[model samples]
Target: MTTLQPDILIAGAGIAGATVAAGLRGRGYSVVHLEASTQPLDTARGDHLGPRVVETLANWDILDAFFAAGAEKRLGAKWLTPEGVVIMHSSIDDLPLPYPFYVVLNHDLIATTALDLAVTAADYDYTLFRPVAARDISTGADAHGGVTEVSITTPEGEAVTIKPRMTIACDGRSSKIRAACDFQIAHTYDYEKPFVVLFGPRGELQDPRNEINSYMSLNGGVSRIPRIGGQWKIGLAIDKQDIGRWKSTTSDERKALLAERAPALGEMETEVAGFYPVIRRESDYWTKGTTVLLGDACHTIHPARGQGMNFGIRCAARLFDFLPDPTEMSDAALVAQRLADYEAAVKPLTDAQLSENHERGLHMDCTGPERMQAEIPTLRAVAADPDANFRYRMTMAGYPDRLDPK
Candidate 1:
């Protein structure tokens, strides 16, 4: 078994991990990223960086690459009532930013691009190893609190130790590193409404508009988001136990459901279908000594608002801002302080977003009498005020303030 020592050790090479690696390297921090998979996972979910996220990417000077990797630029978002009435609409052009409203790209492509940038950046030094799993973590007392050592097992079953000044966990919702450090996470999993997602050719659907279309009723809610290559992504919230019923529902049954619940989608060619359980996890404390948690590792939110990855990207951007000066402290101390500041700065914002999204989900998925009651006020208000529609649109796109740092 071979051992390697680096200034910093990162777990997971997803968007959060890749973004931090690239940013830290640009800031002159040595980083090594480890991943358990040699290739990208074949998951339908990907990061959808909103306008604010785009601004941060622009600052890193890599937004163009994201666009180049088949990201569809969104002009605005629209909210529709069950009767196919447009309640509100918001455009990206109104936002004061360097780029367009937002870019929706495949998650794998974005992560791969970020990783590629980090590996090739001239300003910093870094390394990437895949098929490696972190099995153990140890911390020792130091003048500045302590140092962390991580043990990883490669695909070949060889164990290697990475002794770094500090370690950051970006390893997604089920994080081994967070568990190893004994970090406590306050969380809630809403099994009431699970989701089934489908993806396919855009031409297979009716009224396949480029804009994001949200259809709401008392029984549930469904969203159809357009993507590059004439593709469209569909998500519907249903009872967790009923997920099996959806699977049993023939393609014709699904099409019929779409036609009934979402008439705008007259027809669609589904290429794939997936199921996801809704979960929300947050840690009151995101750091412990030389170890810190980031991205999904630190917090996991419901995917209703499409803010899961967006939140993670924002966390990484904040970590970049709080990075310590290498000259003023040892590598270990620098990493510790940076991790502390990262947690302090990110926790509050994440908590607020979680609350907001949870509420939004409930409002959008109202059914029966509740749906009628909710739509009456929204529809009446939109008709009464023209600006009301615009404001609603902006709110969905994460308006007013961009995701960029304040």
Candidate 2:
């Protein structure tokens, strides 16, 4: 088959992959992006990015594009109890910094914008290969240092050998590149519940005007996220065993359950309903030879706080910071340094976020007398204390200034 050589080879053209590619291209690095899917990714997915994620996008000079692409400015987030008691409210405008707190945009639009920028930039030198899959990766020591040979299957199903300076896997959780490299994935499984995400029109929600609203109920927890085009995305967590029953139930039963859990939703029409088991996994090592993992391939957090895509965006920014100029150093050295810096910069943030989100999920799912007696009082106290609420808001905003490299 045909053989090609590029400065860098990136697998997966999702948000993480596209963002990294755009950053590297700006720095004059040649790249080849391989995307397995031919169609554009679903825009509805990953529609929100926190302030930190916004800052990262700004650094790449693409924030304006994102905003122009119909990204809605999010004011803040609100937390509520089963009885609709407002427990906590955090606003982005309240932050000491001037950065936008959050932006809600179609993920597909963002990816497409970044890709378009990368492909059309004045110094565009990267090639995007669609319908391409990386099947295997072989690493070897070279006179300079280390080299990785990647075997990619093209749309025609022919295996083509591509020897890039390095391979960055921005693939999602089930990354074939990570599997081929045999990287150890450290994961914590949360079987507490399965969640069904419903996307559709938002009828009427006054309390959560331009903000996300989360409700903790005795039966379950639900999060309502506002999206572009006046659509709202709602996630309802249910017992794992109840998933089958929920799926088997008639459409009317499901609709009734939605009404029962989130009465505020009213009569909004649902366009789609997707369900999946909740899981969190992180790679022990982000690098192996010339291959490195980024985004969900490296770590995955619970969707409770809607931080999965945000975390991936941060990882992409870290990788952008560590990327080396191909002309300045050997491919092997650049790859190693980039991988080390990426792991060093991202692991701690992701680890802490994973832990914090797990605890938050547990707290939100709490029920029974123990919750009413212990958790509710503690939450009320935390909510009542201005200092505590301020600190909580800062933490949720990602403490951007504190992300200094250690």
Candidate 3:
């Protein structure tokens, strides 16, 4: 068995983990990241990155590369009727932030970009173990719950033991580190309808300003998210009872159903990406001793608003703010204190986000005329009112407090 020691050990090389690794580079810290998958991650994951997520990328020196890689800009979000009548719209063109617009790109591409830079761009010592799985973990003897060591087997069948002062779990919903640490789930909210994701040529929808148009009606909701190169990612909410038929239907049949449900879209050549039944969940705590949970490992929410990746990236940046320098890794008590501080600062905000997203999911799941009579009017009102529209836009841009006079 080979033994290695690093200042930080991050499990999983997805967006959250890669962001943490990239942000930590040039900070005089040694990092070891492990990825169980041999190839790249699924490309069909969340693609929208909010303004705040772009800001985080800029802070980490990743914005230039992201855009250069064909990431597109979305002005804002809009709500419309199935027949293409606009109900409400929120544009970030006037936002005071540096990067005022949202970014649309493949999730795996961005994560891989960050990981590529994390490994090669900086002079810091960073190691990535691909096709390797964490087989065992041992926590400290104290009650604070820090991990002492982790055991893994490399692709070459070599046994390795990693010892780090701090551990970060970004291994997605079924995270092994989180389970091993015994983080209790505090709450969960499941959406009533599953979303069918389809991607293909943009057809007549050629405007970037209309990229995030959401159509809600008595039938259901269908959203058109534009991608770079004149492509569209369609999100259609499927009834639970009709899901079996949807599964059995051909590609053309699914396209027809989408047109029937959302007439504004008409018929377009597209491919079904995947089906997602979203569930919002949050853990009782995000930190224990020197171990911290980031991204889907700690919390998950509905993807309708495209905040999951943004929240994860923001969490990593916030964590970087609390972490100590390489020289301070030996101070176990101090590290533990900092970990506690991180949890205390971030958990409440994350919990609040979970609640808000759960509410939005419930709102999006509505069918029939009740949504039009009740909720549609309120949304239109919010859009029509200047101050209300500004506040709503700011919040959706991930800067809810920017409106403060202070």
Index of the highest-lDDT prediction: 3
lDDT of 3 by residue, 1-406 (tens): 9999888999988889888888887889888999888777777778888898889889988888888887878898788988888899788877888898888878788888888889896488999999776659888745268688999888788889998888898988878888888888888778898887888765546695745888876677778888767778888767888777877777678667878767767676777778888887777889888899899988887886788888899888888899987899877778889989988887787677778888778877876667656877898899889888888888888887587623
Which residue pairs of candidate 1 clash?
Answer: 46-107, 52-403, 204-268, 205-267, 218-366, 218-367, 218-368
For model 2, what is the alpha-carbon lDDT of residue 254?
A: 60
Total backbone collisions for each predicted model: 7, 0, 0
- Candidate 2 lDDT over 192-269, as tens digits, reads 766677776554444334688876555456777888766678877677777778767665666667666556654556
TM-scores of all candidate predictions against the true structure: 0.88, 0.88, 0.95
The lDDT per prediction is: 0.71, 0.72, 0.82
Model 1 per-residue lDDT tens digits across residues 1-406: 7777666788988778877776675666667788877778445775467876787888887788787877667777666776678765656666555665678777788888888888888867687878676667676665133336777776667777888766778898888887877677776555457777888765543432357777765545677877666677888777667777788876677787777677666476564467877777776578876777788888887777788778877777777677667554355666677778877766776677778887766654444557656665775687467566555545555553433323
TM-score of 2: 0.88
Off by over 4 Å in 2: 143-147, 156-159, 202-209, 248-252, 266-272, 329-331, 361-375, 400-406
Which model scores highest in TM-score? 3
- Candidate 3: where is the Cα deviation over 4 Å? 202-205
Stretches of candidate 1 off by over 4 Å are: 143-147, 155-159, 202-209, 328-331, 362-372, 379-406
User: The CA-based lDDT of model 1 is what?
Assistant: 0.71
Q: Worst ten-residue run, lDDT, model 3?
A: 202-211
Q: What's the TM for model 3?
A: 0.95
